[model samples]
Target: MSTTIEYVRFESTDPTELAAHRDGLVSLLRERYGADFLGAHLARSEDGSFLDFLLWTSPEAAARAAREMPGDPGAAGFFGLIGEVHDMRHAEVLHSTQV
Candidate 1:
């Protein structure tokens, strides 16, 4: 099965706040979505922008989670930490290498 990937970008001037947001979102994803939420990779740019590569089992599953997240009480604390999503896109993984 092809995995769905979400490419996202957000900007934050405060590194500490950004880290906290990232952690909270990751924890929420894991706790709420479980195995359907594959995981995420985060990176910091020189200008303090953040890029998040979120992996999911499928596009449909990802969409459902996204749709419900806003109404989930557990997700409330994570909502504000996301900052401004400068860009967001979904893709099917073509290839990958893991150690």
Candidate 2:
């Protein structure tokens, strides 16, 4: 199966609040997605925007997880902290190189 990557970009004014929300989301990812959740990473831009990268086993798995995220009780606060979603998309990894 090919790996699917979830690329999300959002803007936040409060870094502290964003950190807390990121932690909560990570916890939820582990608790809810478990093995299906390959990995996650959070990054910030010079303009203060945030980017979240999530990897899953497949596109279907990623889609399912996203569809159910808003329904997760723990996600309420996290979602609230995300002030604005600049962009969100999923794509298949066609190639990769490891050293």
Q: Judged by TM-score, which candidate is best?
A: 2
- List the pairs of residues colliding in candidate 2: none
Clashing pairs in 1: none
| lDDT by residue for model 1 (3-76), tens | 99988788755667656766777888898889999988988877777887889999987787768875777666
The whole-model C-alpha lDDT of candidate 2 against the native structure comes to 0.86
Cα misplacement distance, residue 92 of candidate 1 (Å): 0.3
Best by lDDT: 2
Q: Candidate 1 versus the native: TM-score?
A: 0.79
Any runs in candidate 2 off by more than 4 Å, and if so which?
Answer: none
What is the Cα-based lDDT of residue 15 in candidate 1?
A: 64
RMSD of each: 2.1, 1.5
Candidate 1 least-lDDT 10 residues: 74-83
* Candidate 2 lDDT, 53-73, residue by residue in tens: 999989988999889996788
lDDT (CA) for every model shown?
Answer: 0.78, 0.86
